[model samples]
Target: MWRFLSPQILFGADSTEYLERFEKRRAVIVTDEVIKNLDYVSDVSKHLENSETVTIRAREPCIDDALELAEEMREIEPEVIIALGGGSVIDVAKAGRILMEAEIEPEEITPFTSLEEYGFRGKTSLIAIPTTSGTGSEATWAIVLKNIKERRKVIMAHERAMPEIAIVDPAFVYSMPDHLVISGGFDALSHAVEAFLSSFSNPFSDSLALNSLRLILDNFIMSYGGDRDAREKMHISATMAGIAFSNSQVGVVHALAHAAGALLGIPHGLAVGAFLNPVLEFYAERGVERLGEMNRNLGLNILREIERIEAELRLFEYIPVSEIESHRSEIAERAMEDSCIVTGPFVPEREDLETVIERVVRRCMREES
Candidate 1:
């Protein structure tokens, strides 16, 4: 048996206005310093005039951060919680909401774990307002947090972790920096690709993935070049891809990216962007049948399109080959332990992961040379 999950999604230029329609008292806005500086926190706060704002660090969130936010939430006791930043902010808010109601460790919030059994009632409603068009944290049950002590990412998922509402307002993404546009677009592309390739994919996820992949491919470059229409389409596609992956699953791309990002202190989207094509190539080398299915469905060679897109964007230039080479073994080891690894078309052994990482490093080195 399988189930698909999505938040009540409000999308478009002024979707933030939807918040004003609600009659909730005591709302709390959780965001990062960067977004707060952008005045987006104030924009969201305007909808909830009586809300409290909590600004966390603008870096990848950690387990301690979630606990700290949870403590803050407990004090505020908000009827509504709005996460108004990128993936890190949304994830922190999700984990914080759960931690506020229940005393479980952030790492312990897995797919099979029952939060309700641990006194987690849906008392506080979560609304995820993403200021970036990537990660799809607003639409997914997944939560990625850095384990500072372990030097790895903690991939957490629970059915209840999905937000009550997802505000995909294009206005929020309009002023996104160019680097974020490139990296986040690649992250969305990876999600659509990996979701289609996942062993857990269903008919629902397959349709979403295909359309999202098409939307992203059609608009990513234009979006990066500051086309407003393309940017809006990219914004919606990101959420669609997020929904697709959340229902199905992601694969080795996410596994390796999570490991690399946590260990190398790379941004989540940038790591995913760098590793996406390499992992796809690995799957192709192994004769994964799903790639053919995706190709036929899209009426084009998906891998070749990805290659063209990556080349057009000069994505390989962003990652330093030396960093990857120096940390290959650790990345592979950590990737093997990632929960995302098992859901791929085939489960890879540690050596298989190492081989992919090595290939990625070699490819980047060749490009640099």
Candidate 2:
């Protein structure tokens, strides 16, 4: 038995115009301060002419920021909530909308909590517009936030938190640099790979994950090279990857990422990407033959993922195991209790986790001749 989340996605350059397609009365725009100053927000607002649009600014490092955004929504009472940035922005919108409708506090929001309890008091829908091409919050039901009280990254997901609509306009991606583009692509890649390998994985999401991995492998370079066509392909692929993992959940790569994001002030994508191949190598050594099967099923050479990264993206080259050993235990300890950890195909005991972490980080490490 499996469930999936798929939002109405509009992609490509100028696709942001899809915002105009909605017959909304009033809407709140949830985004970061940086986006508010960009010309893009103005363009999005232009489409919502007849409707009153409010911008909610809550950026990184602020987990409870969603509450503040919700406070504003209480007064604005918009007919819709449009998430207008990356994962954090979308999460803020999802969490904010919930609080606005449910009139609840931040502490009460948890995966076990039923969203039906909120009842969408404003009758507002949600539209997710991803400025960055990763995270795929637009396509998933998971909403992650920083939890300052507990000092961890909260996975506050609800089926209802899934966006009703997702707009994936590549025009919004022109501002991203090679690093952001690669980071975002890796975020999606990690999602698909980890999800496909997770204990909870089912055929439904496996298909999405397989295709997503193939697409990233095919176009990551072209997209990173700033090719408009390839970039468009990536824009769509990221969403597909989002849908895949959102349904199946993810694994150790995500476990480390969430912990790093919560503790070390790293970007979400970087946290995941840095740990991805390492965890995979670890899984491969631990009775995870499925890694090879997944590669074969996708018609790809499993070993080539590393080559693809080096040949396509170039430079980031692998790091040495010894170097990564320094951070292994700390990374594993911080990753405890992560939902991803619970769902991994092979959940490592703390001792095993230490070994997996060391071995993986070692495999991806660069050896200087």
Candidate 3:
């Protein structure tokens, strides 16, 4: 059976106001200290003044604090859960909520269990307001976290974890620094590319993935260069890509990033971008037919299909990165086990991952230096 999941999205300025309408006696705001300072958090708190609000200080979501937050929720008795930060905070919210509702260990919250059977009382509303328009956390059913004990990243994904509401306000986008803009664009790029080439991708998701990919390619550079119009398009595309990949799932780039992040705490965008081009070429063999279909939709010549996409997305970067080698072995092993790896048309084995890491390391260093 096929599943399609999406939150009821609220996009544009002041969408954070939806928090006030939350029908609950008490609420918990799961987020980081950084986001708490933003206007988004202040506005959400202001709106929900009638409802008791508690904040979980999850700086990076997957840290050891999640378990404590999970336990705290039981005492807080929050009827509603609102995620008001980036991917990290959103993930912590998901884990904490699931832990409370399921009354299970954090690691046991997997696809096999039926969470709805746990019977959360009331609407148990989940509202996600993304300060950054990437990771598709506002739109997707994916949850990523670092299992600090096991020293690995875990994904607790299910259709129901999809937020009841997704607030994608452009006003928040203006608050981003230049590094965040560049990094966020890369995250969205990986989502579009991985989903577009996913083995499980069907006609429905292919259309969304392709359109989002085009939008990112057309807008990322311009948006990063400070064009509001371009930034707006990219903001919209980030949600679109989230919806697409949520249906089809991401591939190698994500697999590598997940592994690298859990082990070395490398930033998601940089880790994903470091290996994107190599995996793109590797997946190209299985990706060509699907990519050709996208080219057909764009009315482009098939001969230069992926070439056009490369130019449009500026997909290749030969950065002379020296740090990747430090954790190379561990990263290789973890990437091999990532669930997203199997979804690639050409799934790389351990040897292949190692080889790709080597090439990416050498190439990125050359490009950056």
Flag regions of model 3 displaced more than 4 Å.
Answer: 23-25, 116-123, 285-287, 298-320
The C-alpha local distance difference test score for the whole of candidate 3 amounts to: 0.73
For each candidate in turn, the TM-score is 0.97, 0.90, 0.88
- Give the poorly placed runs of model 2, Cα more than 4 Å off: 51-58, 105-107, 118-122, 310-327, 360-369
Quantify all predictions' global Cα lDDT against the true fold. Answer: 0.90, 0.75, 0.73
Candidate 3's displacement at residue 136, Å, is 0.7
Model 2 agreement with the true structure over 79-184: per-residue lDDT tens digits: 7777888777887888787877785555566667765665555377899998887789898888788877666887777777788899998888866678778778
All candidates: CA RMSD (Å): 1.2, 2.8, 3.2
lDDT of 3 by residue, 31-138 (tens): 777776664566676777545445666445664566777687778777788887777777777666666666556665566767766754334667887777678888
The local lDDT score (0 to 100) that residue 5 gets in candidate 3 is 73
lDDT top scorer: 1
For model 1, the local distance difference test gives 0.90
In TM-score terms, candidate 1 sits at 0.97
By lDDT, the candidates rank as 1, 2, 3
